[model samples]
Structures are given as C-alpha cells and as structure tokens.
Target: MEILRGTVAANAKPTKPSFVSYVTPEEIKSESPRPYTPKTVKCPHLLPGEVMFCSANTVVKETQDDLSQRGVFGTLLCTNFRVSFVSDEEPTEDTTQLFKNKLYGQNDIPLSCVDHIYGGYEDKRKLITTGSLVKNKCPSKLIFHCKDLRVFTFVLTYSEEKDAKMIFQGIVHHCLEPKSLKNLFAFSYCENTACPEKQRKQRTMMFDCAEDWDLDMKRSRGVCRLVTENNNFELSPDLPQFFIVPTHVTEADMCQFHGKGLPMWCWSHHSGCALFKTSTLPLLPEDTIAQAYMEKMLTAVAHNYLFSVKTEDLSDTLPTVQDIQLAYSKFKHFFLIDNTTDFWMSDMKWFSSLDSCGWLDIIRQCLQKALEVVECLETENTNVLITEESGSDLCCVISSLVQLMLDPFYRTLPGFQSLVQKEWVAGGHNFLDRCNQLHLKDKENTSPVFLLFLECVWQLLHQHAPAFQFSETYLTVLSDSIHVPVFSTFLFNTHHHRATVLRAESPHSQRDPLNCPTVWDWSVQFDCRAQDLFLNPLYTEKPKHVKSVQRSRPTHQRQLSLPTACKTPPKKGFFKDEADSLKKMLRVKRISRWMLSPETPHPSSATREFYETWQRKPLDHHGLILPCLDGPSVRVWLQRYLRWIQEVQIFGGGAVTVLGKVSELQGEVRELQRRLERHGGSSFSSSNQQQQRAIRARTGTSTGPQTGGSRSSVRMSSSFPFTTLKHNWSYKPAIPTSVLQSLMASGNLADKEDDADPESIV
Candidate 1:
C-alpha cells in the first residue's frame, strides 16, 4: 500500500461549496407557522341522511371465533343510522359470501339493533346503560350486544383518551336513549332523496287500508261484515280503523270497554266455523249489570250464522308475557358469547341450560294451545273465541298459527305477510313498547312476544319444511328487520299511533314521515338474487281443483253412549258359586263384542270422514297439519341462533347445499324435456344414450337395499357424494368423567383441570 499526502496542509481552513436555499434561516426558525390542520378521517358509507356524530381509531377484535383472533385497526364511527367500523385492511368484496345485505355491512350495527352496551376497564366489564354512563368515565374497551344475536368488541387502549370518551358517549346517547320516535333514523331516511320508492317482487297485502281488508274477507269467504265505526279512531285507539266483527255484534258492543270483549273475526274455516280474538273486559263488580253486558256480547258472537262458539281464555292457558321476558333474557345469554372460552364453557351444558331457560317449554305450551283450538274448529266444528289481557299478544300468536296449520294460503310467502299484517299490525300489537324501540328501559313492557311467535312458526316450518313457501332464512331476516327502525311495520304501538306519526310534520324540517317504508318491500334491503334465498324450492303448491269438503251437521247431539247392558244373570245353582259363573259369562260377552264395530256409526262419523279425506288427499300442504309436540321434536332453531358461530358451521352442509343439489336436478330435468321435444318423441341416438350414461355415472347411482326377512337393510356405503363408509367416520369422545364429576361437585365446569386432554381419557 502506498501513502498519499493532501494538496493543502491539514491545519488550513476548508471553504464551503454553496447552493441556492429555498427558505431563509429566519423563516425556518419562525415560532408561529401555518396553523396545523389534521387530515380528516374517511368515514364508512352512510345512509341517505345518516350523520356521523363521532369517531375514534380502535382495534377491533374478531370475536366470531374464540380460539384464534387478529385485531383489525379501524375507525369506529357512530352514525345516526348505525355503528360502523371502517378498516383499510378488510377486503372490499368477499367472493365466497353467498348472501349479501345492501342495507348493512359486516361491521355495521343499526342503532336500533343495539340491545345492550358493555364497557371494560381494568379487566372488569360492566353494563353501560344511559344512567350508568352519565357518571362513568370512558372505558378502554367497548362491547355491543345486538338484538340480532350479534356481538362486537372494540379496543380503545391505543386511542386518545378524549376520542375514546367521545365515541363511547356518542354511541350510548344515540343508541340506548333516543328521546322520541321522530329521532329514529327511519324518518331521516325517508326525507333523503336517496331513499327509493317501495319496491316488491311479490304483492304483499299491507292491510293499511280498507281495500286490503275487504280483499282478505272475500278470499276467506267470511260471513262477518266490515265496520268503519272506528274510521277516525273514535271508538278505540288500540283497534284498526277498519275491522270485521261477528255479523250480529253491533256498534254498541264495540263501544263497551273501548272495543275490548268485542269478538273480532280472524278467519273463517271451510266448515263454517270461524276464529275470533277479543281483549279481556275491565274489572268490575260481579253484579247483574256486568254479567248482563258480558252475556249479551258473547250471545251476539255465538249467534253468528253457522258458528257454535267455544271461548278459549289464552291468558289462562299460555305463558304470561313476564314469563316470556324472563326466559328469553336467560336464553339469549348463552348465544351472546364474547370469546371461544366462554362459548365452549357454555356449549358443554347447552341443552340443560336451554331447558332451564323455559323458552322452549313456552313454545311447546303455545303449540299445544293452538292445537286445542284447531281440534275444536276441524273436528268439533265449533268456532273459537280467543280472549287475553290484550288481544294483541298471545292472541295474535295462536291466531296466526291456527291459520298456518288450517289454511294452506297462509303458508305461502305473500299470505304469510298478509297474515302478519292482519293479525299483528291491523290487530294493534304494542310493538314499539314490546321491542323497546325508544330504549325506555321499561322492563315490564319489554318482552319478546313477537320473537316467541317466530320461534313457534320455526318449529312448524322445521317439522313440515315443504308445507311452507318461505324458507328459514326468510324468518331469520324478518326477525332482524324488527330491530331495524327503517320499517314502519313494527315501529308503532297501534294503527292510530302509526297514522299520526306518518302524517305529522317535523318541526325541525319539512320532510314527510308518511313516506317511511314498510318492511314488506324487501327490495329496500336485498336485491332479487338475494331475495330468492327466502323462497323454499321444496314447497309444492296446493292443487286448484282440490277443495275442503263441507260435511252435513249431525241430526242429534253426540254423547258418550255406554254399551247396551246385558240381562241380569238369573239366580243359579247355590248363591255365591252361581254369582261367580254369571260374572265370568258377562266378561266373556263384553270381550267378544270389543272387536266388533258399533251397531250404528258413531255421531263423529263426519269428523272421521273429514280426517280420512284429508289423509287421502295427494297434497298434504293444503290440509290440516298437526305439529309433533314431543320433547325431541321441539328443537332449537339452529339456523337463526348459531348462524354467526364459525365453529358450528359445516363447510359444505346446511340448506344451501340441498338447494344447490335441487337446482342442479331441476336443470337436468329441463334439459331432458327440451331434448325430448326436439326429438319429436323419437328415441335418443346411441351417442346420446352413452352421454346420458356418463352423466348418470358422474352424478352417482342410487340403489335400494335388498330386504332379507322382516327388515330392509340399508347399505353401509354408497356411490352418493355425501355418503360415507362406516370405517371412514371419526369418533369424538364425550367430556371426561372427571370433568363432569368436577362440574357436578363444584357446580362450575371452569374448576376442572385446564390441561386435561379430551382424547386421552373418557
């Protein structure tokens, strides 16, 4: 290596090579520069008139699955319409999603859907109600429990203290404590120009006007006459302006109790019997005057042409509204799980816990009551008069259920909507109070009566899937729609209340609330493709030629007639011995005639004939359908309750799979029909036959197992795609005896060993 020396001495000063500078040193050193302006946060898309009140950066935890979760950094926004979370990391579109909702995004929860809010601080979580939030500081974590059985968690640990507090208070005030009905997002949405006109693929009878009610009366072939006595709501606020009562019931009968205890016609059976619902009479002295009025009102209802009325006191037979509230409160807790640990912990004893909740038991009781009313109408040929504290609650439930089972028309999608309109909306159920739409915190008034009705309907749909034109998905979505305030269908307590709200002008704006949309217009939420999921492909329509037969009335009243008594045995041989022999002879005679038919056909021959005719009918969808009330038959609606639980979801299972298979088969059938038409009844060519054979082979062939003696055996394995061989099946062991024993001993499964391996022992 060679050493080199610099041209100048090391001690000499160096000169700087200068270039032009854009800013001077004085300008750069200025203490007061342009006022700092923070970049604006991009909010998620809002509804037409939805206004964002506050927002904060939050780490959203994936609570869908408990075992593993990744936090998504997003801005949590509180809008008038909903609580939305916007994340840059989330994909804009999911190709795998089969059902897409236009009204709500995956992270969007409607303000009305917010059933309960919880705050977490220092590892402890407490309910964040309006009253509690007033004095409490903002929490580091926030959780939302929704009416649709959805749970969301947001972490505010990384957010600014002020931002977190602002967002927390905003959500609490807007969601849990709305001041009036006008404040609901629905009114705002109606005012916006973006809100579209009511669009419906199918015609749904709203029963909002007299024409709809008249059409229903004509369709049911009802004998009752419609009255406009309450046209201006001068008679009763709870009743619709236009309603049909028994023909003999006069305006004076309706005036009593303000339409209470007035039997209103629900539907007419083909047998000339009808269903009626009335509210209970006011408490009065058990004197002659009260009794006289009650007798006169009931007499008018019973005297209706061709109706022998049987009064059913629903309050005495069915579970009370308070009981339903308590049961549902306990039942919903099992589903509102925050983490995998809590989910698994609850899953272990889900059945027993569900039973203890009493919800399913209530469902069973409601079904049994409906069946009793059905029996009276179908077999006894007597009209039913259902009375309750408020005819709107259980009365609507049983009436709707009766129509579903008795009238095939109600099983159809349009008819189902019409039934809800007729019995619930037109009947004036207090949906606003019962659903807690205003977030009033009135525990006594808030109950899941409508939810209970839906659950009952689910049972019927599950047991008789093909009987209904609508799918379980329809019911599930309809249940969620109740919490969405955009629907005027369930927003008000009475018809008059709805009318007043709709016609009333806003003081703050010139918008008309009358334009508020109804839930029946499904296009407001889902497009045609998405709406197709609501129709069941398996439903077979009733044959037009088939009609319910009207049987003639019996000449004499039927009574329990005992077998003709045999002649008293004559005193024979010596006293006691002769008596024993005579008794034995009498017993023999009764046993011999037991197998023989009655000398005269029983007076219930009409009932038996009707039942036999129903059984012989090719279509079971239109005729009477009795629900199986056995314990095993009353099942949890898994589609509605567990749809969000990722672990419980089957990868390639559920109704979607069945629907796909059905569609494929239908396509094949159509293709074959077209080919046959093209061939003009000629046989297929050899090549065509070969192609068909190949198609069949790919689809798999089904063969019936051969019978060997009394039993017909099923093959253990098949060529079907879903069929699995016995050896290929995997066995999952039950919970270890020690864990169960620990649970029994300690009354808590959490006390068991955490490290215990399930497969190792049990």
Candidate 2:
C-alpha cells in the first residue's frame, strides 16, 4: 500500500501550488523605492547677498591635466557672485599649504573674472556670446577662460536636458549681458557687507576727496594748489572732483576744453621740477583759435614756478591703446592653454611667438618713455607734462612709472597702493571699459593699460629687488583681484563714476552701496597667514637720516629780477667817426666789465658735481633708480605667467630654496643675539657694532654693481648648472624629515634602494 501511494504522489507532484494575493499591483508600484535620479543640490557657501539663479546636477569637471583625462562628478551652479562647481566626493584639504584664498574656492570663478566662454558640441567649439543660448542648442561641454589665466571645463552630458540648458543660459545672461552698472555684484555685496570703521580707516588712500589731495600735495611738497571747481563733476566727468593745477592757472583756465589740454600736477621733485599730465586737445587743424589757445595754455604751464616745462606726447612715443590691445590679445594665447600637447607644441617657438606678439616691445617703449621723463626732471631741471589722447591710459602708465622710478615713497607696499589710486583711479582711467567688466563687447574701449603699467613696475622690482617692500607674489595677487567684483577700487572709470555708484540705490535692496570695500583691504579675501606673502623679507627700509638730509638742503633760488635795458647803438649820422669812436668805447667798457665780474660755475662742472654727489651718497632705496632698457634685461614674469602651469612648478627649487636658507640663517642670528643679550649685553652691542663696520667696509669697496648698499646677486641655486655632490655639499637638505615622514604615511613617497655610498649620503 505504501508503494502505491508513493507512485501516486510522484505523478501528482507536477501540479502547481495554489496562491492568494493580498496586495494590488498599483499599491506595490507606489510603495516600491524609485530609481536614483540626480537632483539640484543647494550651494553650501554664499556671500552676504549672493543669490543662486540656476543649477545642474550630475556634472563632470574635466581636469586640466590632459594626460590624466580625469573627471570629477559634481553639481554646477550659477549665482550672481560666481560660477561654482560642488563635487560629490569630499574634498581633501591640504593642511600644509601656507597661503589660502578665503574669498574664492578652487572651483569658483567670479563672473567678472570670466574673460571668455566657449561651448562645445559634437567635437566642435564656438564662442558663447550674447543671445547664443537662444540661437543654438544646449552644449554638452562648457569651457571658461578667466582673466587670471585660469581655465575651467565642465561636462553636462550626464545632467538633465532642462537643467543643463538652465545653467548655461543663466551664466551667459548674468556674466555677459548686464544692462546697467547697478546690476554688478559689487553694489549688492556692499549693501550687505558690514565693513568695520577701524578697518576702513586703515585702508589705502582713495584720493576721492579734497582732503586726500591736500594730504598728498603736502607729502610731496607740491607748490600747486588743489581746485574744487569740478565738485559736481561739471568741468569734465573724466577729471577728478578735486585736482592740483599750477598756481598760475585759475578755475577759468581749467574750464578750457572741458578740462582737457590743461596741465595737472602729478608730483614735485626735490630740484624744484614737477611732473604733470594732460589730455590731448581735439584734432581740429582748421580750428586755429583752439590751437592758438592750446599753445597759450601750454606756455602758461611752462612758466609755472618760473621753470621750463617739457611736453611728452605719449601717443607719439609709445604704442597706442589699440596696439596694446592687439599685442596682449596675441600674447595671452600662449599661456591660456587647454591641453599639455598644445603647451609643449608652442614651447619650441616661445620666444619667436612672444616677439611676434610685440608685448615686450610695448613694455620696452613704456620704460624708455619713463626714463626720458625722469631725465627731464632729474637732469634738465624742467617740469615734464605727459600728454595722451585721454590722459587716462598711457598718461597713467608713464606718470606712474616716473613716480615709481624717482619717488622712493611709491616703492613701498602702501605707497604703491597710493600711487595706483592717484594715477589710475583718480586720474580717470576707464577701468570699466578697459577691463570689460560689464562684458560690453566693445573691443575699441578694452585694453590692458593697467596690466602694462604693472608689468613696467615688475621690471623695476625685478632689477632692484631690495628697493621694494612688496613681493612679486603681491603684484600677482593684485592683478588677479582686478576682476573681483567685491573691490570698488577697479570698478568704475573715474572718481565721479565711483561717487555716483556709491550714492545710488541698489535694485535688490533699499540700502545704499556707499561702503564697498577696496582691494587694499586684504582681510576681505585673505587671512593673516596669506597676507604675509605680500611683504618682501629682503626689503631694506629707507634711512631716516637720508630724509633729514634732504629736508635740510637749501632750495635752489632762481634769478627773478628783470635784466637791465640795453642802450640803443649810436646812430650813424653826419658824425660817423664820432659814432664809431662811441661804439669802440662801449665794446672796451663791456670787455673790462666782463673781465672784472666774479667767475661763475661752468654748467658741465655743476653737472659733474651733481653726479659725484649722487654717487658718493650711500645707496638709498628711495633715491633715483634707472632701469636697464637693454634687450637682455627685460625678462618674462615667471611667477605670474607660469604659476598656473603645473609642469613649470619646481618643487623645493628656484629662488625659494635660497630664500628659505636666508630665512633660517636670519632666525639663527636672531636667536644668538637674544642669547648674548641674556648672557652679556655689552658683548652683544659690540658684536652689532662690528657687524655694522663690516657692512660699511663691504659697501665702500667698488667691486661690483650695487643696489641698496649690497651687490645685486642673481637669485638662483648656489650650485646651478651642476649636480655634483661636492658642489651641493653646502646646501641644506631639500626636503625636511617631517615632510618625508608625512609623505611616507600617505604612501606618496616611493621607497628606493640605498645604492650610494654612506659618505655621499652624508
């Protein structure tokens, strides 16, 4: 019976099992988890008044290193403040970094900083201009070229179509198509930013008011007086509200040509000569009256303080604004590279490319022009009037260069900032138009005039390192800050424009934008640690005794009395013999009188004396400095142009190695001095005296060219061009033990076999 049941069970096993359903299909579908879809992620950090306009998720940021071809998954965002990318992966912070920017992060690019934007689709790229978003389809890739030579690329293939389109449109609209100056982020930021009064007081001089001008004049011992005729900007919108003019000129003279073609005082020299700048009169050859008046105005300028004036037409001497723009346009391409292949491909023809660009030629021309002006003031004892078409472009350039060369006050950090304010901002340079901050697409109005001036300054700083109190890093950072919208220093075209903007009401809020901070307020962008990079450690302060000596020197007094009238020659009448006898007597009297008069100093001897005095004086950083205008003397600014390129970064090498060693030696000496003070104060004082004597003795010898009492040494490795162990024995270890230990812990340092001898290792 059991065998029969088993057979039946086996035959019935193929029947399907019965089931009962408790849940409906619709309910199951609703309860189940949905597929993962990218969603908009809000930006974690925003400025005081920043507003996010659009965002796209699942974006990929392409790394600049073309060899790696790596991509970072992130979310791309567009706000009024900047274009930012937030990565999905947690960012690993480098604690070892000595300097860090607080205003902008690694993935952030300010809207004003965006020089050009390109969109790529199907292996083709096109510039994204105004209304391009409406004319073309949404691009899969967007590339940003910044004014600071930074390039950023973002891929939007993984993002939703609508989200991608929204972000692209948002960036183009806000970054390139602002309708008015009020729309800039500066006004909004100023509205919300609560700048401390103490901090504002400590910032650089703006030269925006009459008091600042007065203070500047007093500092320079200027003989000209400040005029407030343009208090309401009535004379000319381009001219400052308050400016210095010759004592001979009146308010009525300033009204001529809307304040154009009038000599305005820039600075005064110790030799009773002054530097002046003016705008060119309109090119109306047919208007003889205007030309005649211009001549008369210039003649009056020449008589200022009873000194002759030399007029330098910069438009005739230096490159035109258009020429500058063209040269810079071609020059910037070699550095704004997207891939390693292109960079290396262009490296072989670098010098030829640079020459063809004509940028260095422009720099040379500017330096030559400044040197000429310096000669006029220093040697010729004549006032120099630098004139250009607008007086805002090259006028600012040449005038600023002259001051930097002749005036020691302009070489320090604060003085440099003040010089920029006086020459560029207060001088009415069209920074808004030149920098294209509004992205107006007006090519004629855009030129890197300020950058050219900075380049010229860099040349001086490079040639005379110890003369400047600021480092090259400071200049590099300052150049980058020009595009940052938070600073009011480079925002407007003129003092009047800045004033108008500050008083105007913001569209976003009821607050006035009067408290906008300037770039000199470094606290807004950098912490104290980063701010230290702006100061040069090798700077030697100008001696106090030198200033006193300059002040004590008697001012040169010129002969102010009118010459004696000459008696008319005896008329040759009937008594011709008598007339000849009278002329003979007069000639003999003049000869006797000339012979009896006191002997005067020869002009050449006076010049030789001046040269000897200048040479004999101990080197003064604040004294006259001449630059080498030779071809080989002009060098590329490596720290600026190549800083962004990773391949050119020489880790633990270059001048930094020598600078580090010097810093260590300085610390050791300081420590020793402190110990000696604790042990024997008198011995420490004697040691200081001995050091001073040694320095004086070293400076007295004419062994080599000197700058600031010390020979100008080339900043390079002591064992340059060779890698022998004997030559490198004097150098400290390149990497510290602590750094090596950390690198090992991070698995970044590779282990190597000990193949060298123990003596060589030591």
Candidate 3:
C-alpha cells in the first residue's frame, strides 16, 4: 500500500474542519477561527465515511518514538480510528508536505493499538485541606501499560481537565470493548454504499467459505491428543495393552478404560509431574520384575509432556520398604492391648504393653514415607507411580497421602471422604480383605497402610491446625468406622470386588447404585458427632474463579509424648468438675503405666457405684472389652465415656476432640498481627512511595531530538514506535437501581450456595 499524507479529496465540501490538521492550510487556519466561523468540519485524515464521535481543542506535547515527551506543542484531533496531532505553528504555503501529506512532527496513532491504562494514585478525597487552604493538589497523571509491558505517560493541564477526562475515558472504553466480527473482517458499510445488496452477498459468501474451510481442516485433524491416551505403543507382550498407565493423565483427563488401568493423574502445573497407583504384577513376584514399565510411561512424557516415576531400584520398591514399615507395626500390635484383648489384660499387662509398644516410632516411619511421596510431587516436581503386591495396601497409603498433601480440598470432611471414595473405595483398595484380616488376627495379610496414612494426616493437622477445619476427633472416628463395617469404606470396594463379596454373602441381593450406601450415611448414624467432626468450623470457601492459595508444608516440631496423667483443670466450663474427673480416668486407661505386681486388687464400692450408671461402649476405644470384665477397670473407661455427653452437649470438648478453640484463636491472633504489620502507621505509605520511586527511576528523559529525519536518527521505543499519552482520567457512571439489585441478588445466591456445602471446593 502506498502512503498518503495531507492530500484533500477533489470533491471535498467547503464545510468547517472538526479537527485541526497541520498539513492542510485550511484546517490549520481553522484552529484560530474567527467569531463568525462556520460549524466544525470532519478531520481530513479520517477515512472516507468514518464518523467523528467528538474532538477537543487541546495542546499536545510531541514525544520521541521511545514515548518520552519532547519540548514541542501541537493541536490534537481524535477520530474513530486514529488520534492525529498537528503542529502548533501556522503552516505557510512554501512548506512542502513530505510523502503526500505525512507532515513533519505529526503522530497518527490507531485507537485499536492501545493495550492498557495504569492509575496508581490514592483517592484524592482522603487528602483534605485543613483550615484556610486556598487550593488542593490532585494527581493529574495516568500511565498506559501496553503490549510487552511498555509504558507511556500523559499529563493534563488544569485548564483542559474536562477535555482530558473525556478523552481518557473514551480511549479506555475503546481498549476494553470487544471487537465485533465485522471489524475483524475489515468490512465497512461505505465499501458497498453504491450497491449495498451485492456487497452484503459477497461478504456473506466470503465468511461462509472461511467457516467451511476451518471445519474441513479440523475434521481432518481428528480428536486432539490431549483428550486421548493411546499414542504410545510401548507395552509388554504378555500384558494387556490397557493395563499400562496412560501417557498424559491430567486431573481433568477422564478415564476411558472401563475404570481400570489406574491411569496417572497429573496436576495442572507446568512441571510435567503426575501420580498413579497400580496393582503389582499378579503373576510375578515383586523382586523378579523390574519396574521398567514405569520408565516406559515416563518416556512417553518427552512427546506428550506427561510425567511418570517409579522407585529407583527393586530393593526400594513397595514390597521391601513397606515390609520394614509393617514389621515395626507388628511389633507394636503384638504388645498393645487393643479392644480384642482388653478383657484379658491385667493393669500391669496393659501398662507393660503401652510402655513397650513404641507406637510413636511407627508413627515416625509412617510420617517419613508420606513426606517422601509428597516431596516427590511438590518439591522435586517428579511424577510418581505407586504399586504394591495387591495395589490395595501400601499403594493406597501412598496415593491417599499424596492427594491429601497436595489437594487442600481433602483437608475438609466431605473432601476427605470424596478422596476416600475416589482413591480407596473406588480405586480398588481391598478394604474388605484387609479389615477381615485385622478382625481374624491374620498377621501376614493385615497391613497397617490405612493407619499409616491416618497418622501422616494427623501430623500435618497437628502442626498447621488452622489450615484444616476438621479436628482429630474426625480422624479418630473415621478410623473407628473401619472396624464398624457398616461405613462405606469397609462396606464397598471396587465395583467388581464389591460385587464378588456381595455375591458370596447373598446371591440374590440387588447390586444397583441405589442399593449402595453413600458416605453421607455417617451423619445418619451419629448426626451430632458427625457434624462436629466432619465439617471444619474455620474453613471459608473462596469463589470458584479465585486462584487457590499456594500450600506450604507444616513446620516440623519434636513430637510430644501423650500426657502421662491428666491434671485437674484449675478453672473450667459449667461441667468442669465432671470433665476433669472423666478426663483423669480416661488418661489413666490410655497412658498410665503401672509396675507389674502379681497382686490382684479388689475394687472400691465408690468406683463400682460410678461405673454402674454407664454401660454403653466407649467411642474412642480401639480394644474390645467383655461385659464380664471387672468393675474398677470398666469404671475408669466408662466415666470418661459418659463425659462425652457433657463434652459434646455442653463444652464441645469430648475426649475425641483433639485441637481446641485456643489454637484457633492463636491462629487468628497471628493473622491480625500480620495485618497490623502490613498496615501499621507509616509503613503502608512508605511502601507505596518506594514503588512509585522505582517506577519514576525507570522513566526515560522527557526531552529528545525533534521529529523524524532519516531512519537511523529516529529513536524507537525498543523496536516499536510509541507516542506518550496523559493521565487524570476518571469515568464513574451512576449505578441504576435495577443493576444494583441484580448484583446484590447474585451475591446473596452465591453465599447461600457456599453455605449449603461449606466443605465443598469452591
């Protein structure tokens, strides 16, 4: 296209000029129009048939191509498509318009090209003038932040404030408004004004052709690779192709393998990391097969941006590492007198078990393994493939721990249970077989994987108590539900696994989705207790569009032993005396260690009388106790058990309630302290000033050479030419009653939805 300058149309009307143009003598003379001048004419530079919305008579400061303002002035004219400035000096007939009418020191900037507007000054209303102040200063600068984060500043003179505000708001409006499809196609009404119908038909035909071409090309491309996982052909010949993990399995990537394969689930980070849990080779022993399939899965990542990881060597695989973890668990289980053995154990025997079991050591090991898997996914950005002999044991342990660590949603009760459903119950962890083994005392098959995961979660909750809503009571009750079989975790395994178990138990039982129990049933059995433990009181759901807060690892502190004996509270709630008495008895049964004496002592009448009023099973008890067990031992357990009513109903501090309001209050205090530091006295002002100083320091010198001569003499803003534009633009439209009401209604509805399911991911 050839460049055009100040040349006028041959048929140009003798109307007044709306814009002040420097190249045209007629337009330049109009800038200083006489009292009886005719109405303003359209800007000469505007395209044919383009309309002018408005124009203002204001002085413009010429700027370098670097966007630095120069010591030059001109009259500015803004049209629909572009903003053009004319030289301040009156044009003479001898002055030649270079390259058509492209005048020296004139800028024609397209309205479509402006990208951003920055206004950082604080509200002027706050800066009030005290007694007898003649005038108040207001910030009059606005910097436009545009493509490539480049900046240009503008300043409005006090006299032209009204015009400056209008132009500023208009430019911003043009920048934000979505461009119409017609604009994108460069179709204009003027192009077909002479034959409107014919032009419309041609435009429509062109659009139709483009649409058909795009459709055909897309159809030929087939489904996007992102949604499919069958790209890689690598698999073991003996194994089914479907058994291997998919190459790219994001959290949003759904499964298409009939609910098997244990597809890897990637988080939406650019780190190319993923997590998957798969069953070990059923026909091969753990030591015999190398986890080369894992490496193969990872190899696909180079092409697909997927990630997969496996333990480095066979020696460090789940079977060997978890074997050592389970050994420690067995050692503790062998000594501890749980509910099954509680009826038979003497006081001395119980004490000996508690003292010798070293349960804390097991807890430590469980925590370490969980942390290792978490670190892999988070810190190292490594993908992980966790597999065990049956996939239900240690594999379940690792998968659940990793999800809980990374997905903050699982920190709440419903989220926790959804994770259980997705990861354990639905993922095919053999809850039935494992719980059965524990019940039957089958040492070999019984793994402490579930317990290990719970302990790991406990460590996190214990440290970063504010980050989670559910208390330790929730975890304790959840663990208890496993033994209680009626809970869904124990009742339902995978569809095939559950179906098999049900078929054997009752051949005619219906196996429909409706017949299966949901995890919500926990509320049905113990509504009050479930509500207390299952929902977090501290959790505040953020809007769905809000970016999630980055989670930080809980600080590690030296693990503390369980308090040996409960000390009576100096002051308490209304039921303080009852609470202390019950706590004292509970602590004795839970943590006290007695010397092993052969003597069997008789119970006191007072203790016997106290025990008679309580008969129900203890909520926190893991050990089974026969009804025939002696009264004193039973009394100690029952008094604390009865206190659950007082605790739950009155004080809300049952034995199961681990972390109390004191810690929650502390967290709030810390948050307030941070806010204080952030907004204290002069700190906020000082910080804001520091940022302003930094921005000003980077601004180029405002004075530069005059307008273009040769290309080498012209300085551009980086590689692109830019003309600095002004600040102090304000646009505040009055809110309509209908719009205000609608906004309020929508906000209220969102709050209601949030309240309905407080634990849900917002």
RMSD versus native structure for model 3: 32.0
lDDT of 1 by residue, 1-762 (tens): 122345344545776858777842322444667765453675766778888899886446554443345567778888888998888576533433334666777788998899889999887999998886767888888888999888899988777676788888899889888568888888888777454655434567877678787878777777788988788999988889899987777777778668877788898865456888888876477666656776666665654433245677778767899999999999988888776666765766667788889999999888877876776666555567888988899999999998888887788888899899899998989999999988886668899999999999999999888788787778989999999979888899999998888878443565554577788888788765456557665665543233322213332111111111223323423434554443333211111122133773442353344445445556455566767776799999887777665445544345434544665675587578679868786554543333333222223221223212221112212211112122222223233457555556667657545544434324
Backbone clash numbers for all candidates listed = 1, 0, 14
Worst 10 residues of 2 by lDDT: 721-730
Best by TM-score: 1
Model 1: lDDT equals 0.70
Mark the regions of model 2 whose C-alpha exceeds 4 Å error after superposition.
1-42, 92-97, 198-203, 283-286, 506-513, 544-619, 668-762
* Model 2 per-residue lDDT tens digits across residues 144-206: 988888888999987877789999999899887855788888878877888754243654677
List the candidates' TM-scores in order. 0.76, 0.76, 0.36
lDDT of 3 by residue, 664-737 (tens): 35346656656896775523333223322221111221122432332221221111111111221112222344
| Top candidate (lDDT) | 2
Ranking by lDDT: 2, 1, 3
Worst 10 residues of 3 by lDDT: 587-596
